[model samples]
Target: MNKQQTPITFWGIGAQKAGTSWLYYNLSKTPGFSIPPVKEFHYFDRDTKYPSPNILSITKTRDRVFSITYLIKAVRAILSSVFRGNFHNIGFFLKWYFSNYNDNWYLSIFNRYSGSKGEITPSYSMLSKDDISKMYNLSPDAKLIFMLRNPVDRAWSHFRHIKKRIKGFKLEDVQEKEIIEFIQSEGQELRSNYLRTIENFTSVFPKEQILVGFYDAIIDSPEQLLEEVVQFITIDEQSNKEFNQKSDEEDLPTKEIVNKSIELDCPPEILNLLKEKYHDMILELANQYGGYFNKWYLETYGKNSVNENNRLQNTIHLN
Candidate 1:
């Protein structure tokens, strides 16, 4: 298909820290798949803010120049796009960051690839209803990929990630109270809410279009999970003229470690707190989406994890 006619194949709306990087890396290396060099385009859910905003994307230009992190990200995106060795994409990147990014401009980023194309932006899970509606208007038929982790496990992992970013970050140096407050915060609450993600997307798209995967599968059957995703895309885009055929049997794919988290085991007390706080959310998740998630609930909250967490809390609280 030509560039203008090419439709977006899929989107990875994610629960952050849930194997998105690994998925992106595998897809980038795999033949026949054409993804943008920059993994998180943040198109559907970016701040879209700059000092001087465009009229069409009204209020997109945020007053973010004052923040160091925003400046770093802005510079990084432009630099990555420039150094990608594709001259045409520079124009696309310029328009993406500076002007109103219409659907065609967004398509220009991936249409360069003859095979299947899409992007992964985990933050899109938290997109507002208006933004998600905008996404629907652009590519209603696009497949969505959402990966979930155990609520407590995912929250703890995300907390640890924040701490780990500091210089010489250590599990021992982190205080228990800090972890508790972090878990209770609105941000973490939103990230771990698989049900909200389900409800949000289903508001605009059908159930079959969304693929809810498990973090458990990533550890247990990485190759199978990757293949399943590839198959999912291929089924939709089979008619694309330039799509490449799957490789031979001997060319088996090898999994690469991408953004592996530090192995700081969750304290039982913290685990108990997480479980207690997110009990309903987790239970609802288990009820709605079974498989390893169900087993995870039984094995985690209902089994030894409960006793272990309570014991740790008893030592700390003495209540």
Candidate 2:
């Protein structure tokens, strides 16, 4: 297909920290698949705030000498356009950034590939309704995939990730009582609300167009998960791809180690609260989408996961 006609065949709508990086790496390696060089383009979910035009506009009010310099640059740009087919200077890094957020610019990234093209931007799950509709309008045929983790587990992992990024941060240095409080405030609650997020997406796209898989299952059976994904996207089956672990995941802290480091293991109270909050949502998913998610929840979290338990039945609280 030509550049203009090319369509993205798949999308990894992320629950952040839910194996999106691993998925991106594996899919990029698969035969006949083209993934962007960068993982998170943030084009759809983030505002494209390139300041080039604003800078030029503000520069218009500068003194005579500066005005002359601007005029000279404009003239030079014109000459460069005519002689070298370059309308802008090579030093304009924002030009490249500006292009990244545009539809044509995104499409051009996959121009050389005729096979399945996709991107993994986990934050796309947080897109507003209008933006999601815009995405659907652009690529109605795209198969969307969302990988979910137990909300409590996902929230804890997210907190740990943020913890690592902050300067001088240490899990052991933090007070035991404050760990749950900090994670609650810092965690991405919107991401943890899988049912709502999926509902919003499914409202815009048909049920068959969206695939929701759990992180536990993906980690446990990645090859089988990927095989199902390949079938869903109708891409040519890949025989040589390894999906059980991230290609670059070596030397990373193990999940057990990470969990052990957290005191109280995310506070049983908060964990129970999260379970109660998401109980109805999970039940709806179980009833409507089948046992994949429900069964996974039961198997992963045990009896404490659902509201059917007497203690959790009265713990429902809305955001």
The candidate that wins on TM-score is 1
What range of 10 consecutive residues in model 1 has the weakest lDDT sum?
310-319
Each model's C-alpha lDDT?
0.68, 0.59
Q: Write the per-residue lDDT of candidate 2 for residues 1-319, one digit (tens) a residue.
A: 3334647888888888777776676676655566655576666765433211123222113332256665675556555555875433332322333332456655555554457888877877776677789778777778888877666677777766767656677655667566656545522666777766776888888877787655665545565565566566664445223322332444222222111222224556666766776666666654444445556457545633333332211011111
Stretches of candidate 2 exceeding 4 Å from the true structure: 1-4, 48-100, 166-168, 175-187, 235-264, 290-292, 299-319
- Which 10-residue span in candidate 2 carries the lowest summed lDDT? 310-319
Question: Candidate 1 residues 80-199, lDDT tens each?
Answer: 767877666566556555544556677666656666679988777777667788877777777888877777788888877777678777878978888888888766777777777878
Q: Can you give the TM-score per candidate against the true fold?
A: 0.77, 0.66
Clashing residue pairs, candidate 2? none
Q: Can you tell me which runs of candidate 1 are displaced by over 4 Å?
A: 1-6, 47-104, 236-254, 303-319
RMSD of each: 8.5, 10.2
